[model samples]
Target chain A: MIEALQFEFMRNAVFAGLLASILCGIIGSFVVVNRLIFLAGGIAHAAYGGIGIAFFFGIPYIYGTIGVSLAAAFIMTAVTIKAKNRQDTFIGVLWAVGMAMGVILIDLTPGYHVDLMSYLFGSILAVPSADIRWMAGLGAVTLVLTILFYRDILAISYDAEFARLRGVPVNLLYFIYIALVAVSIVFIIRVVGLILVIALMTIPPYIAEKYVRSLMMMMVLSVLLSVVFNMTGLWVSYHMDLTSGATIIMVAATGFFISLGVDQVISFSRKRKTQRSSRKMLKTKKDAL
Target chain B: MTQVSPVIQVQDVSFSYNREPTLTNLTFEVPEREFLAIIGPNGGGKSTLIKLILGLLEPNHGRILVKGRSPRKMSKIFGYVPQDVNVNIQFPIAVMDVILMGRLRHRGHFGINKQDRQRVMELMTMTGIPGLENRKIRDLSAGQRERVFIARALAADPDILILDEPTASVDTAGKTELYALLKDLNETKTIIVVSHDLMIVSSYVKSVACVNQGIHYHPKNEITETMLQMGYHCPVELIAHGQPHRILKTHGDF
Candidate 1:
């Protein structure tokens, strides 16, 4: 693992993983806490439409994907706000339509032979320096904005109505937050691809949520957890020649299961201890008699 | 003769959802330092009136003025305590963090200010939930959670404090204690509570507004038979502990 960092591609992979972790740690915390996992999944899959649009129009991938992804995100946000009862159905439709559109657009592109598997399974080892720079820039912007509006975001995530009554501009902030989520989803697609992007955004935060008592702590811990999973998955997949994106998701899933098991064990032991104490007290009462 | 404007004035405000009118031509006024209760049956537009006052929804026909301005623009002056926190119980947040979020105005960039922290602690002390500041919000009991939310609402120091069904989940004793707290808070902050809890409305509130599709403001605690019949389809009968049973008339038919 130490020697692997010498290669430029490996260095880029590690750097890209770090950038992805930062974005996931910060934005993912908001996503998981606010229960926006499905919305995010919709955005990630819909981002495929952006990629397809880029290839079809012979433009850069970032431009087309970001543009279309943001548009889709705005549409989803509007639907979620206006017709909340039917948002799930609409998001499901958008998710499928985005994927179908991406496939159809790619097929329609002339003289283009793009490796669809790479986009689906991710090619972290093949990440270019330019993309890494883009990831860094996006991550920085997200971090600054998140910190600047941390209180408002926290208020909105917990209870949007209360946030509005407190002068938090809930609607405007919600639009901006969803837009940022869309942008982050696009950059993360380069690291883990679109299919596994939701996992990367949610798994670590879900785990961190169990242990931490504040959003900030949860985000920081989630970042560390994400880094660990990304590095370990990258290393394991590198040695075994497995798909990096799938491996990272598997690692996160294993961690999630382990945490759940550990939580159960802790609670079960505590309950047993209480029961034992009560039984001992009963025995002592009988002994006194 | 010039006079101080009421803290909240809803002048013939009408609202609808999906073109189905919920509140029609409702008019009310909440004066300064007053503890008022807005009570009605389910779907009687009680919650809608509160939402309109908070500017979460706009009135279609008439206007609502909070401190002589629009309700939406008066957010800083209105502290709101929703019926339920409506937060996921498993959300990882401390009691203090929940209270500090109320101080989310234009303070500093990163952390809460010293004055804000002091104010939060003061509110915690006042609400009698000081020691539980570090506890997880989910760990607190229902009553304790209500107190924490009250402390959070008061942390903003708003002139008007609005609560929606505050005692919905609280026990009888907790409800009494909460009423006492609100009665004390009314000394400084104007309180507007939306509830269906008739018992408390009879006990604590200085004024009552019976809202169905419209509002009938009663400037005193007495619940008149006419007000009850107008607000609810049937007049509520008080038949407990040897209390006189007032025969209810439904839609003008016995």
Candidate 2:
């Protein structure tokens, strides 16, 4: 298993996986807490339009995806802010429109028969050194920004109105958050397809939330969990010739259930211990009387 | 009282939602360091008026000024505690972490500094929730959640504090504690509250603003039948006092 790391493709894959894990861990916490998973999904699928645009215009996929995803994210954020009461309906419309545009554009590309399945699912083993470099840069930027605005993000995520009243630039912080999600999604699409990216972005953070005491701690744990699932999924895919992205998502789902089971067990034992101690105290008081 | 510029000023302000008038040609001023309670019936534009002053909503007509500046310009000078801080309490966040958010504006986009941490500690101390910094927000009771938001708001050390129905969901003990905290805060900072509990507010606040489509200011005194009739759109009679004071009335135009 250790010798498998020697291949250049394998090395690139591991690097990309680690970088992607870090990005997902940091941004995914916000996504889960803010209930922006659906919005993130909209942004991810909307990014396919960028792929189509990139293929059509002969631009780099990363730049095109970033540009298009940012635009979509801005629109989504603006709509949600302006009409918060109607967010679900508006986000749903954007998601459909974005997916439809991507499909239509991809169909229009002349004489190009690209393997859409690879892009739709993902081929982590096929990640090149260039992709790994891009992932690393995105991961670094996300980590730095998250650390810098940790307090503001925490306040905004929990109670935006209160945060705003405290002289925090709530609107500006919200935009920055959306932009970070866009960046994360652009890179994440390469590891998991647009359809499954939200799960990858959400599951680890959700699991980490149970054990971690702080947002920062949750981010660290989520990254570790994401890496574990990614590496395991990659290994399984290599051995069984399975799809990489789907396998990773399956592994993550398993981890989520296992974490839930563990939490229940811990809570049950704690309850029993407290009950026993309370009963003992009651018996001691009775004897004293 | 030491005289200072009015902490909040609303002049000729009018607001409409979806073309339906909520507030019309309203004018009011909250003096610095004064505890003012706003009372009105539901859908009477009370919350709308507060939101306009807070810059959460743009008024359809006229202007709202805070600390001698428009609401947009005075965004940094005021702190607000909303009616319910439990709107998303189930969200995975800690109480201390939530309080630290109040210093975000002062610390900028980067994380909190040592001063920021100290400020959060101070707020927790002031709010009497010092040891609850590590507790998850969802695990707290409603009253505890309210204190966390109060700490968060106070973290900025603003000259004015505005709260919307702070006592609505709290118990009697929580309400009393909240009023006492506001009373102490009023010694040096302006405190404005929006509530429907006229009796409790009358006993605690320095002055009261009875608002429906408009507003009528009253100095500290027992709320009168006429005031309740106008503010609540119903005939109100004060019943009993000392131990238990209640308002007796039936729906008139609510």
Candidate 3:
């Protein structure tokens, strides 16, 4: 792995993965706690429509993708808030429609041949220096904004109505947070692709949440956990010559199952110990009687 | 002449959702340090009135004023404890963090100082949940969770504390302890609780407001027969105050 890091593309991949991990760790914590994974996944899949528009219209991919995802995000947010019972149905519709639109538009684009499959499964080894710069820029923005509004975000995520009453600008913060989710979808798309984005965003945080006591710790631990998965996956995939995106997902899923198993074992032992203690206490009480 | 302004004033406030009126032509006042209770049937606009006072909703026709200022402008002076409908039970947050979120809107110069930590500790002790700050909120029982929320509400150090059905999920013993805590807090802060736990709350509140489409306020603890008919929109029995689960009047079937 160290020898491979001498290559420029390998270095870019590592940098890209690092940036993606940090962004996912922070944003993913909010996403998990706020239960916005489905909506976030919808935004990511819908972003493909933007990618298609970008290719067909001969525009920059970033602008087109972020624009469409943001629109999808705003619509999804409004629907979830207004028609909560039908939120899943609307998000599902948007997800499929976005994918379908992307496929159709990419098909119609004439002359310029592109490997569209790369956008789905991702080509982490092919991450250019420009994409790394974009990821760094977006990661910085995410970090600053999260630090500036950490308390407000925490308050709103816990109890929005209470936050509004306390004048935390709940609507403004909510919309801005969702918009960031849209932008961050573009970030994950660069490394893991839209198809596999939610796994990287959700699994680490879900595991971190069970171990941490605060949202801040959850974000930090989740980032560390994500970095470990990315590095391990990249190393394994490099050796075996496999797709890096799916490999990272496999690593994360493995970690997920291990955490679950460990949690079950801990609880099982706790129950057995409590039962033993109770039996001893009962015997003592009987002997005393 | 010198006069004391009301802590909260609602003058002919009306509100609706999608053209369906929930509250209409309501008028009321909550004075300083008063323990007030709001009661009504479900969908009778009790929660709506609380929202209006908290500035979460605007009156369609009239106006609401807090300390002679707009509720929105004086928002820093109000502390709210909501029904917590969307509280994610699996959310990974400690009791300390949950309470600290109450101070989010407070404009501290340095941010989260030792003073804030001290205040949180004092509130935890006062709320009877000390030594549990490091515990995860999900690890708490329903009763302990209620105390945690109450501590969070008090963390803001606001003059007016508002709660909506705070004891709904709490057990009978927890409910009594919650109301007793509110009564103790009312010595310094003005409290307005929108609750249906009438039997338990009546003994603690100094006044009562029955909200239907309209509002009828009695500036004393007693509930009149007429107020029950107006609030429930039907013939209803009043369970005697101070004696919970005891029906003061029941039909001949019993």
Query: By TM-score, who's the top model here?
Result: 1
Q: DockQ of all candidates, in order? A: 0.67, 0.56, 0.66
**Residue B1 alpha-carbon offset, candidate 1, angstroms:** 17
Candidate 2 displacement at residue B129 in angstroms: 2.5
i-RMSD of model 3 (Å, 1 decimal): 1.6
- Misplaced by over 4 Å in model 1 are A281-289, B1-5, B106-111, B233-239, B242-254
Query: Candidate 1: which pairs clash?
Result: none
Q: Which runs of model 3 end up more than 4 angstroms from their true locations?
A: A81-86, B1-4, B107-110, B169-177, B198-202, B233-254
Local accuracy of candidate 3 as per-residue lDDT tens digits, A1-289: 9999999999999998899899899999999999999999999999999988988899988888989999999999999988889999999999999888888888899978567677877778998898889889888888898888787888788888767766777888899889888898887887888788999999999999999887889999999999999999999999999999999999999999999999999999999999999999999999999
Give per-residue CA lDDT, model 2, range A1-289, as digits (tens). Answer: 4688889888877787888899899899889888899899889888887888887777877887899899999998998988888887887887778778777777887878557887788778788788888788878878887877777777777777766666667899889889989988888888877777888999999999877778788899999999999999888887898898999999999999999899999999999999999999999999999
The model with the greater lDDT, 1 or 2, is 1
- CAPRI-style docking class of model 2 based on DockQ: medium
The CAPRI class of candidate 1 is medium
**lDDT accuracy of residue B131 in candidate 3:** 96
Tell me the TM-score for chain B of model 3: 0.87
Give the Cα lDDT of each candidate: 0.84, 0.80, 0.84
The 10-residue segment of model 1 chain A with minimum total lDDT is A160-169
lDDT of 2 by residue, B1-254 (tens): 56767778888988888777888888877887888877777788778888898888888889888877778767666778877676976677778777777666563445567788877888888786888888988888887788888887788777788888777667877778778888888888888888777555547778777777777776553454566667655212243664333233234522
What are the per-residue Cα lDDT tens digits for candidate 1 across A135-166? 99988888898888888888898888888877
